[model samples]
Target: TRKVRRNFVAEKYAVLIDALYGGRASQYIETQVSYEDGRTNKVAAELRIEDAETFPPGAVKQAA
Candidate 1:
């Protein structure tokens, strides 16, 4: 797993990372921000692992 950081401010933003194997998306990470209310906004982040080589089986770990 990898960690990415952005230093900026915006009203809406999206970040996506896709790992491709065999010409297909085997793993991905996504983050999205959208307006939800006048004072608050919706924020989401997702990580999906489908390949064993990319995401090994064992105790899950996060990159620093």
Candidate 2:
């Protein structure tokens, strides 16, 4: 399916995922957002984490 299967597989890229979840959810993010009117404005948002599920130990082999 060309997917890395985030559950068990993403741990292979632990450092990168760690950086994403590094701090509190209430942290603010700032970036530039462009509008259709050809004008851009700074945007900010509060980062948050969401829940996900993982496959059972033997379940991963189902694809094979």
Candidate 3:
């Protein structure tokens, strides 16, 4: 008699790696970045971006 192997066993044994690393279990809030001026910048939600269409009528260039 042949032994019955389960194909579902492999699918259930998949390993999931989390962002956790080292002895510290804290999650990173923002990534550390830098500018061309040799100054570092902390990335946060405070950054503001104006929509291109919301700019003043004459502020943007139009296609000739």
lDDT of 1 by residue, 1-64 (tens): 4554453322213222223333444334344445556454444445453555455677678689
**Which ten-residue region of model 2 has the weakest summed lDDT?**
23-32
User: How much lDDT does each candidate structure score?
Assistant: 0.42, 0.64, 0.45
Judged by lDDT against the true structure, how good is candidate 2? 0.64
- Tens digits of per-residue lDDT for model 3, 1-64: 5765565433432221122222333333444588899999876432232324477768979899
The order of the candidates by lDDT, greatest first, is: 2, 3, 1
Instruction: Encode model 2's per-residue lDDT on 1-64: one tens digit a residue.
Output: 7866877556554544664678434445566788999999997676565555898787766454
RMSD of each: 13.7, 10.1, 18.5
How much is 1 displaced in model 2, in angstroms?
Answer: 23
Quote model 3's TM-score.
Answer: 0.24
Better of 2 and 3 by TM-score: 2
lDDT of 2 at 26: 41
Cα error of candidate 3 at position 26, Å: 15
Best candidate (score: TM-score): 2
What is residue 5's positional error in candidate 2, in angstroms? 21
